[model samples]
Target: MNQDALSRELALRIGLAARALPDTDAKRLLAVLADCTGMPMTESQLANIDLATLKAAGQGEFAKVADDVLQQALDILKNTASEKILPAVQPYEEGEMPNSVRIACASDDAIHVNGHFGGCTWFMVYQVNSEEARLIDIRATDIPAGLVVDDKNIYRAEQIQDCKVVYVASVGGPAAAKIVKLGIHPMRLEAVASLADIISQLQQVMAGSPPPWLAKAMGIEVSERFKFDREAVG
Candidate 1:
């Protein structure tokens, strides 16, 4: 991205980290902004940033994302906030698409889908549109061990019901049944695989001629063709 886009990007990052992370971590997020800006910022400078002031002044690199967009985002977040405002993991790598789908990965780290369905705590949520695949949030599930099978299965399914697809290393019969009951598709992948690459493959599936199951998973009507370029299908 050009400097103009970079500035807007950093400002958005600040808005997200500022809204989601603690004050200290938000202060440290300045380092990320600094890294993008190619300049070093002192803690004193970062510590002094007030949301309203920064929202209004929008000085220097922060100017591009100024006014309504950033302001609205900043107003909605707090450290004690329970609701999640989806976070961006990566910038759009390809051209942005008009339609997108959300997926959940059963994993410990957000970078890999390698966790057992029953025992995993972290659910890496991602939004995948035609143009890009980006991380949105890392959701936590509190299905305690020693719960009965049905209860734990329902808890696991409930945690990711918002997602249309879920990737995991393994899924118990009961857990998979509950997930299917919720109308979310369960997929088994290798214990360790690149999350980005997996998202990319899904992107490709959407881009090319996807199978009936995949097309249905994406909620695309088969009659639509979904812009699939037959020639591009290898």
Candidate 2:
């Protein structure tokens, strides 16, 4: 959502819930609303909006309150813009192992894992869980093509250090070791597939029969939850 629109929506929500929110919270959200909207509003106006109205707001009406609240709260404390929501890890679906996971792909086109780690120029970071997978950012590499820098893998690894896994067309042994040392798994693929296809595959894995490496990555213990095909039993 756009900054102005986001600010307005937060303003309305805090306003509607003013009766239920703490006085300090009410004041903070109200002030942010004014700053964001560039309109003056007194505490009385904020108090006038009651809990009933907030309860009536549809889910869409308050699509991003938790995220916006944290952002606006930080902005208020720091006296920053407090309008745009900061990008952060989103909550995942219930029963989804590890709750959430972040993955990075070496892709110039942003749709496939089609680049060598050392030479790739773009990396797409995404948040993945069972219910949904969302693209968070398309980060650019600091190094340009054909530079042959000594720290090419270092640079690429640093770009996605926070990610759990990185998909690439190729990775050198030393480079792969560097990535592994940083606790990031590297997957080398001979042929790249569409990001959508990758996501579909991931969803299928989450649905059933996740392998040991995957179960470990997702923080799921290998236990009775592992289902077996009854007919296949000897």
Candidate 3:
């Protein structure tokens, strides 16, 4: 079922539901819903969908997904609208932090790094140096109509092209490769964690001696990057 055929409210619900599941989008979800609930799914019919029907429609697609995640998706489908709590973005300016690296974090909620790279609702960007980190911006991943899944990844990568590193709860191999090709390093933390904790750890690493790859990302010269390790050895 194409989004155009559905009411604006139903379309939003489907989009939210799709984002709740890993590596899924509205178009794909609509196909699954059509196959399971019968074609030409209507607003009232979708609102009545149950978890069992959703699971049957998944056909093992949700096998690895947590029960809570599925429940969240179901909630989106059942409700007309759900409130989204997001962290407030701090003020920032270009050249605010010299020698800092910009990081992109895939997140559904603003407070946690709990999103899959391909289907995440938001990318919370931060500018970080050894001393501090600041939330710079939040970019939404809104897929345009008729775009395929592969193109979705490309579009997401482009959204954070200026970031030096990207952190996600999960990322597919193909999506990881695409981010890498764009000069963005992709890091995974499959379990949900507070974004503050993750950023704290990153600051600790930077304050001491960052790994070579991280150093490179901060624009440090390759030859000078190992000085900390060498000094400790000596």
Candidate 4:
């Protein structure tokens, strides 16, 4: 079958699997699936959907959207398996050191060395070992940052310029517009707290077993932070 046809089949199979769960789980699963697929689920859509229909529709693979759904599903299954999952893995402490794995505090003004950089003014560079991000460097220039500028140019500069990722807190519209043109992924975080929580959650999710929602999938695997990515597993 063609790619589209295959995607539809996958969606259909996933829908069917979702249908077999308890009503609450099924509803939650459907919602998560819908979000991952980027398709709005109306009441009728929710009521009438079946594995066969979803497969027949040819919606295909849920790439970008699947990460959130898979994570939620795993969390639900983990909670069902053990009520202490969150607390047992909680990284926070009472008035002690920050619980985040790699946090760039507000005062530091230095971005974390991930492959994704947000905004326009600042950007990042890195080397990849087997497509895995490693040895990233954060840099800044005179250009204003954020989403307003030509993102493609920044991406090209980064690509040819030999950088893997960029991180920034603030970006403008024109700057953001410019950077996207270069095809670089931007990682935007509002505050230290938000970034810390996400990092902690990801760590908890990765070390556990595959959640019920993803156990049957072919290539699905959880990362150290509990986030799901196609290329995360070796």
Task: Give me the candidate number with maximum TM-score.
Answer: 3
lDDT of 1 by residue, 5-53 (tens): 3234345545675554334255554544454333543222333445555
TM-score of 3: 0.61
Off by over 4 Å in 2: 1-98, 143-150, 227-234
- Ten residues in sequence with the least summed lDDT for candidate 1: 77-86
By lDDT, is 1 or 3 better? 3
How would you encode candidate 2's per-residue C-alpha lDDT over 1-234 as one tens digit per residue?
Answer: 122332453454454444333344566555444443335543223323333333233422333445444444433322233132222334444445344567888864443567789887678776677766766777888777677767767878988998888888888999999999988989887776645556657767766776766667677776644545433563
Between candidates 2 and 3, the lDDT winner: 3
Determine which window of 10 residues in candidate 3 has minimal summed lDDT: 1-10
- Scored against the true structure, residue 154 in model 1 reaches a CA lDDT of 81
lDDT of 4 by residue, 115-220 (tens): 2233233332322221122213334444446545454445434432332222445445554555555543334556332222333333354234544333222123
- Relative to the true structure, how large is the alpha-carbon lDDT of every model? 0.61, 0.60, 0.78, 0.34
lDDT of 1: 0.61
Best by lDDT: 3
Better of 2 and 3 by TM-score: 3
Itemize residue pairs with steric clashes in candidate 1.
Answer: none
For residues 1-234, write the lDDT of model 3, one tens digit per residue. Answer: 112312454567779889988999998888878766676665445655766777777575565667788889877765523676444567889888877999999987555688999988899999999877877788999976776666879899999999999999999999899999999999998567667668878989987778888888777775687876788999
